[model samples]
Target: MSPQPQAAVGAPLSRVDGRLKVTGKADYTADHDVRGAVHAVVVGSRVALGRITALDIRAALAQPGVLRVISHLDAPRLAYRDNPGAFMDPPVGERLRVFQDDRVRFCGQPVAVVVARTLEAARHAAHLVRVSYRAERPSTDLTAPDLPVNDPLPPQDYERGTPKEALAAAEVRLEAVYRLARVHHNAMEPHATIARWDGDRLIVWDKTQWVQGTQNELAAVFGIPPDSVRVISPFVGGAFGNAARVWPHSTIAALAARVTGLPVKLVLTREQLYHGVGYRPAYTYTLRLGSDRRGRLAGMVHGIRAETSAYEHFLEGTVTPGRMLYATPHVGQTYRTVPLDVNTPTYMRGPGYATAAFAVESALDELAHELGIDPIEMRLRNETAQDPSNGLPFSTRRLRECLRVGAGAFHWDRRAPAPRATRDGDWLIGTGVAVGCYDTLRLGAQARVRLDADGTALVESASSDMGPGTYTSMTQLAADALGLNMRKVTFRLGDSLMPGSPPHAGSLTMASVGSAVQDGCDRLRRQAIGLAVGDEGSPLYGAEDDDVVVLGGRLRVRGNPARTETYERLLARNHRTHLEVLGSFTPPSEPERSSMYAFGATFAEVAVDARLGMVRVRRMLGVYDAGRIISPKLAESQALGAMVGGIGQALLEHTVTDHRDGRIVNANLTDYLVPVNADVPDLRAIYLDGGADLDAAPIGVKGLGEVVAVGVAPAVANAVFHATGRRVRDLPITVEALL
Candidate 1:
């Protein structure tokens, strides 16, 4: 199909749902008004590693408005079937079996649930339901000695020439260890679920990224057919990654509803967020790079240790870019998962790339300094036009352009080379830059497009918005694809009753689900065209099907606007009611052999107080080559939001757990800081002009959601290093570290 005019794809269109959201008419999961819904509060274990000895629910059951207290002892028996495919990581070994057997592996594991008429009553009753345990010392440290190491893959060693020999042959070599603190997905909306059972059918309204995943999990838990359960999540406030999986709280809410025979609503408190869901596991990365005096990289080696829960093995893509980023004859990486006494960790924003980029980019910057070379020049000299891992050409890589544009925009030529040379009063001002990269991921997605004779269109998919404007972008794409105005199109999502679609993650929503929408709209448009041309009495009758096209809500010839007729007029003449088409986009079985990734360059300017040890970001700019952008406004919003999130990860966010009792000390938002409006200033994003291989996907879009955040931390850290001459490897670059 030939490309249509860029009416909605590249236009800076505002969100279609902006009015609904701003007017408080959009319905989130918690906003659902389920009649006769009772509140349920969870009672968590106080110890991290222990055996629950006794439980007392007598006082809680006697409280006013308290309906029931359900624990493992009183809860209904489940099938306890083990299915690894059901979850991202299967429930293996003694799965804390909520309330059944009290062998707590982590602190805040649900021990009991209190159901009552009011949220306050349930909360108070939960506090009264006491439990005792036999506690043991827990391993909270990521670098502790007793951490069990699991080998996810064999030694990923690549060598065209010996790296040791290359290092010895090279004139300059730089090695450094980078530490990243554990970061939480502090999304604005907390995880919540309202579960009810009607006979054998289970209906749940959950705040989740994957509605089908939750349905599958609930089916497995209850040993019921998956078709019997329905998961509805029409809106999600924000889910960085925390809502990607079904947590224990969700299961507890379902159990509470089933046991008490009433609709139960559960909302996790801020404190429970620290232990209930997944987080970005702390990482300790050691990197060694060998480069010549001319700044050509000869060899590289990386060693990484990431934290995981004792019960399950969690692994991230820590070694992905190491094999493909630069051309290195000798490269070796050893990625190990260190099992600690904590809940399993999952992907957070950029996941492994964010951690890996910090080490790799920081090491590259260090090497540039060692060689006395400009960082941009050094990167360009060592840039690989093809994927070194598989030897495939890039689909489209303008990383060099990104660097050039960013350097010009950031005034890199004016930066002082020496640390602490630029000062403003008591503050040291320095600028730093780093490269960002993330893979272009595509998954199977389905969408339905319906065009009525009334000149209105409706698009439905099971994908999620999650505060990234999925509804608005998909609506815009549909409006353009079907030749209808934005006002005449309605996009519906976040409900399992719609056509099956992939989860909204991996930055693939636009490429995957949006492609599906395009397919559906094209099919619907063609059906309308067929209807117009097939009728002998119609104006387009006897016209070649190939020459007929739909635009501006009219059936017209490709180049002749005089022979055009409005869709409503055509439909009225033909006595047609409506045209509907169901379309799906499954990724091609054989993708073209190319390095498909979204790339960017982040430049940061930081101001450091020499006396009080404070670091503040003055300005930041991100230059991106993330394929064809569908909505420029939303894309810019996503980039800016990611930079803000990166600022939090690099400076303020940390889930501090007290190892003495396995309690999270700073779980509340008041103690755990995030970047406020006053903390972030003057951030901008610039997207390059171009699209990747059109054959890659229908929309020719590479994922951009995660790429914006991949390089932000390192840029800020590099700036801090240049500002105060202090090389802090750990995250949050605390005031104490600067002192």
Candidate 2:
């Protein structure tokens, strides 16, 4: 069959919803206008690791506009049925059931909720609700030597061959410890949920990336059927893996509505977000990598530990990259989750791969230096077309291309090889490079398409756009597949009532949801063509269905453009109101023959102040071999944002915990440092043209969001080391570390 003629795919088109967002017409969770909605504010515990001995809310109840104060003392018992989703999944022990008990697991744990007619009254009443806690020392310090080590569940911890013996016998050996600090999501829109219950049915206007996950969780908690609950989140300001789960505040909002017989809105304050939602857990990773003098890897051993909640285990794909990234004969990895008195962690943008890359990529850079090899050349030396971990052929591995393209684009050859060799005024300048990779993960998803007789189409799925341009991309896919104009195609998401979709995460939406949209549109177009051809009254009725092509509301014979009929005319004659179909994409049942992954190379130039111990990233560039480009403009934006996030992880972002009380010292944006407008400068992203991972999906697109961030932090860190000749294994390479 001939390749589909592309009209919209890969175009640098502007976002279809850009006007709605800029004009303030888009409705986010808290922006939803609900009638007679009351406000709810949670009162958090003051002390860490304690139980509420006594609670007092008389003053709060007496406050004006305050309807009721619900606490563990008088709160209704909820079923809190188990939801074992891997994304910040509930604890194996009892999940943090709202108001189910008086136990406090950490500071900022909700002790009570004050509901009122107005947000002001709710805020005032929440402050008035007093609490007394029986405090105890919290084990919040993850860096402590005595923290218990539990095996990193299955598939995460792996061993092959005699890694220890191989390392000991290797020609060159290098071992280093890398530390990463806890970091909050700090999405632009704080997690908000507005919930209402009527008889047995419930409705929620919330900010969530996974509407299905939230719907199921709410259904289980209320002991209602999944169909009884509806979740609508059509727009999200930005959620970098923070809004994927139904957090405690969402439950609190629903519970308050159930108790008061009125709709309740719960918007977590900036401070409340520190604990109310999920975060990237701090990790201590020790890597012992052994390679030959030519930089060919002999073996590697990874000893890793990351924080988790005391009640639940939180895991990410942190250790897999170390085993699969290189061609090594003997590879061994041991990962442990050190449960701490903290909120259970969830996926961040790049999630585990970013953390692992910081360690693995930086260590590789160190090994390159030790072996007197260029960093890019060193990585090239150990490149593998087959996954060393599972012995599967790679569907697409372009690390070498990324390295070569990025080096040329970033002018890598001009840099001096030695540390601190280049200088600008008082600034020590250096350049560094690293490789990033992420598996192209696609999940089953479905989309509903309806082509109306009026020459318009609507396609929908229960997905979300966390500033990744989902709306634009899906519209492009539908437009191309259905041969409709961009204006005639409307793609909707973030609604549980729409067709089922997997969570909008792990950079899976494009491949999973896009495939469904394409399928749906193809069927709808074919159906319309079939109707026109079957109708003897219609023009060109005898033409073969295969020869017909729909473009811009006109169905025409591909071989003869003159033979055509408008969709309106064809439908009017057939007496059909619309053509509708539900399209679905499911993962293949058999094991994949090849391991699919997206690859990218990041290069960084940094300048460090000699006396003040300050570091500034001068410029950065990333070249990627992501499969197919859906929308060039949006793809670039995604890449740039992920790179910015990587910069924050490498230089500034850190969630400081007062381990003495399990309190996050920098809970709000003001205190917590992230890369702001001034911090991001001269960043560029380039994509390899027309490359597609054949095994990933029909779209042939490997996900881009995660891989863009995977190697960024290490690239910056490597540059810092080259600039100052000081290797700081710990993340957010602080000024103190430089000194």
Candidate 3:
């Protein structure tokens, strides 16, 4: 059977909520109107790690409108239950309990809360509450964190072939240690939450990408039934991965509301954002690669260490790329999260893949130079149709196509083979390329669809749209499936009251939640068609189910447009008010027939000052083989944003921490650095035509958001190496490294 022709899915439609956002009509988490709501500001501990010695709150209670002060001394000890709701892969260790004890595991940890009638009163009262602690020197340095506390990932050590022997027998070998600085997700909107208690039930408006995650976490921590907590997050300004987890601030708000018998609101300040929320932990990866004289890999080994909190051991898929990206006969990898005196790190954008690619891609570029091979050619020689780690055939891998397209667009032919050979006066111009890949993960999801008699539909799901176009993308799916105009459909999300859903990260929203929406719309369309055909008064009473189709809210026979009936007329004749249906998508429990992942190639052009050690990215291009383009405009935006993130990772962004005290020194935007308009270049994206993965989902899309930034940093780093005769192993290749 032929695929259904899409009218709105691939079109470059503007965001459906763009008008409301620009007109300031959309409501964010803190913008909602909650009756009898009050302010709640947190008071963080000053010490990096130690025990709280004394806490005096006499002056704070004297302040006007100060309802109550909750701290470890006075507050009731919570159940502090354990659950794997906040992206816990295997439930390694216990999660942090707010105000449960006096031990400060990390700096800026919340120890007390100040609740009042107004935000000003809360801020003033919080300062008045004096806190003294016996500080202890924290082990905050990222060089070599404490190891082997707990490893949730299976196969903590993996060996495919005789890697040791292959390395010893290789003709050419390269060994280096690549370091990436600690990074933070500086989303546009700060994390905010408002928790209200009514009897035994709790309703919360929060800034989170996963409402179910917050609900589960809240229920687990307080020892309440999961249904008792309701999380609502209709709109989010921006969230890469910071809003995916249930942070300590969220739990505090709920606890404060229940304790005070009033609605409590909590917002994290910019300084607290550095330590309160999870950030990409700093990493030190020592990689050793052995290849034949012709640039063919003989063996590869990865020794890695990353930072995590003393309580929870967080881990990601950092070793998967080294084992699978390139076809090596012998491979060994060990990924360990070192326990430290810091906050528990969580997923950030590409997460483990982005960090791993920095080492692998950069090493591949170095090996190509040793063999006198083109960078792009060097990767193509090692590309395999099947995953080397698992030996499964890829459902659809277009990495070769992406590289070819990006090379053609970037004009890869006009380049010198030797480093420092291409110089334009003061600026040395050069180009570099790298490949990126991400496994397209999918899960079961459900949605509720209601179609009114007036040719309008409302779809609800427990999902989120944190800067990505969830509202717009889901609307397009419903519009195309039901043959209704885009304006006739209204999609709702970011509410726990809706059907259950998975976390909004991992670029799986389109494949998982989107399939559910399509299923619901299809069922609703079939109900209307059945009503028209079964009725004797209908124009096409004898038409078959497949013969009838919906078009512009009218039911017509496939061949005869004259034989048509409007939904309004049919519903009036049938005496029906509306049609409602439940749609669901359950991913196959059986093992997948093939490996599925999204692939892309990033090309970067850089100009470096040979004398001054200055690097400027003049322009860049990305060619993606991400399965299908759900929304053309948003897909392009994802590409551009990923490129920007890549630029920051390569040259500018870093979270500086005072290793002596384990305090984030550069917490605010003024102190920390990010890529601004002046730093961005002429960015462009090209998605392959008909690049849909039918095996992945019904919508034929793999995932775009995560893969765009996977290889970006390495691409920029390689470009810098080509411009100047400098091979910097550390990230943010600073001026000192070049000189």
Candidate 4:
């Protein structure tokens, strides 16, 4: 078949849904209107690690418009069937069972729920219900030496060569500890769910990243057939992996709807979101490195400890970078999870890689300063030609290019090698750089496309758009593949009935779902070409199929533009109203032949007040080797948003927990600081032009959203060190630490 014309795929197009979003016309979960829907407010426990001694709901039931109150005493028993196929669920332990028992594992564990006619009534009644608990001190500290912890999973711990012996014989050695505070995903739209039951089938409007995953989870929770549940999530305000899992509140909403025989809507309060959803778990990383006199790495040892709830074990790709990022002969890693009296943590943006980069990159900088070598030079010396852990060649490894391009753009040649050597008045200014990487993950996906006789088309998949422009990007791919104008194609998503799709996180939506959409459109276009060429009454009826091409819904010979027929005329003459096709993309499952990953380099400049112990980021830039950007405008948006998040992680964001009672002290947005307009400075991103990674998927694109955030925190930390000549190991380089 002839190659389709390239018109829309790489064009810098604005989001198709931008107008609806800005005008408040987009319907998020809470905005959905449900007939006869009641409101529910959860009542939480006051103490962690306790058992409910007594409970009373008389006052709550007496309130006017109060429909019902449910607790362990009267709440019906749910099926709670096994959901082994749920996405990203912990493999070791069971999920929390809402209102099933009196034992409180953590503070803010929902003990009861109040249902009423209006949201106001639910709020008023929820506060009226009384409860008492037998409290005990909780183990909430990751640094506590005596805390009980589970042994690391096999994948979390690794070894290569003889690291200990090599480290002992190395000429130079450095050891440091880094701590990262727990952080929450403070998306603008709160997690909300509305559930309605018609007979035995369930319909749910939820805030989620994957509608199909949510539908399967709800089906398993209710012990019903998977087809009995339909999850609809047309628009997600923003979920950086927080909404990927099916939380207990969603089940609670369904349970209340079943019990009351009325549709129920539950919206987590702002404060409740802290304990309601998952977060980026705090980490304690101890790193020891050995290198030659010229700053070439020889060996490395890593000790990782993180927080997880006692009920389940959670792990990330925290130790993978140490094994593969650099070309080291000897590497050893050990990871453990400290069980705390808190909720289970989930993936937040960059997940494991961000935490690992902060430690590894900062340590490389320290080693470079010790050996009197430049930071960029240090990283370049240790760049690997193949995966150190598995010996597989890279599909596309561009860390060197990312660093070189970023240095040229950031003007790193102007930076001083010595800390505290560059200053302007009361401010000490310095520049720092770090490399970031995230695995290019691809999964099986499918999309459905339909072309109408009216010269328009519709493409759909069970994907989602949390912040990145999934709707727009898919439309671009379809428009290009089908030889149609962008305005003639419409893309739809976030419904379980459309087609199967992988989870929206991990930066794989475009590589997986977009590829499927492209395949479907390509097949539909070929079908049209065959139909036009075979019809005796059509123009250029004897034209070879390989020499024919479609553009603007018109079919013509390769060299003759005058002999062409519009899609409308061909379909009308054939007495066909529409054409439909299903597209699929399944990644190769054979043994690994290549290492696939997306990489970037981040550069940050910071200024520190000499007398006030304050650090302000002046400007930041990131250069990425993410292959074949489908939508340049959306890619820029993703890169800039990730940079802003990195700024927050480095200097502002921290989730403070009261260890005594396991309560989040900074549950509200006011106390949990993020980068505001005043805190954010100039930021820019540049995507290196490169060929597609055909090994990754048909789209030939590597993922972008997560890798952009990986190296941000460490770059800022390195900058602060350069400015003050003092290295702080912990995150959020606070004024107190600086002092």
Identify the candidate with maximal TM-score: 4
Over 109-205, each residue of candidate 2 has an lDDT whose tens digit, in order, gives 8889999999999999999988988898999989998887654345356899999999999999999999999888888888999999988899999
The deviation in Å at residue 383 for candidate 3 is: 0.8
TM-score of 1: 0.97
Q: On a 0 to 100 scale, what is the lDDT of residue 471 in model 1?
A: 87
Candidate 3's displacement at residue 720, Å, is 0.5
Better of 2 and 4 by lDDT: 4
Name the better of 1 and 2 by lDDT: 2
Task: Name model 3 segments beyond 4 Å from true.
Answer: 1-5, 86-91, 144-155
Off by over 4 Å in 4: 89-91, 151-155
**Which of the predicted structures, 1 or 2, would earn the higher TM-score when compared with the native?**
2
Candidate number of the best lDDT: 4
**lDDT string, candidate 1, 1-739, tens digits:** 4344446777888888888888999888878889999999988888889887888999999999999998877788876555454544443343445666768889888888899999999999999988988889988788667666765434534455577778777788888899898999888888899999999999999999878878887888788987898999988989887787788888888888888888999999988888988899999999888988899999988888888888877777778878777878778788887877888888889878999998988888888877888878888998888888788998988899999999999899999998888999999998888898998888888998887889899999988888889988998889888887888899998877888887777788899999999999988888887877888877888787778767778878777777778888877887878778898999978756777899999999999999998999999999999988888999999999999998898788887878777788998889999999998989999999876546557788898999999999999988998898777788878888988
Candidate 1, run of 10 with poorest lDDT = 87-96
After aligning candidate 2 to the native by TM-score, how far in Å is the CA of 646 from where it should be?
A: 0.9
TM-score of each: 0.97, 0.98, 0.98, 0.99
lDDT of each: 0.85, 0.89, 0.88, 0.92
* Residue-pair clashes, model 3: 1
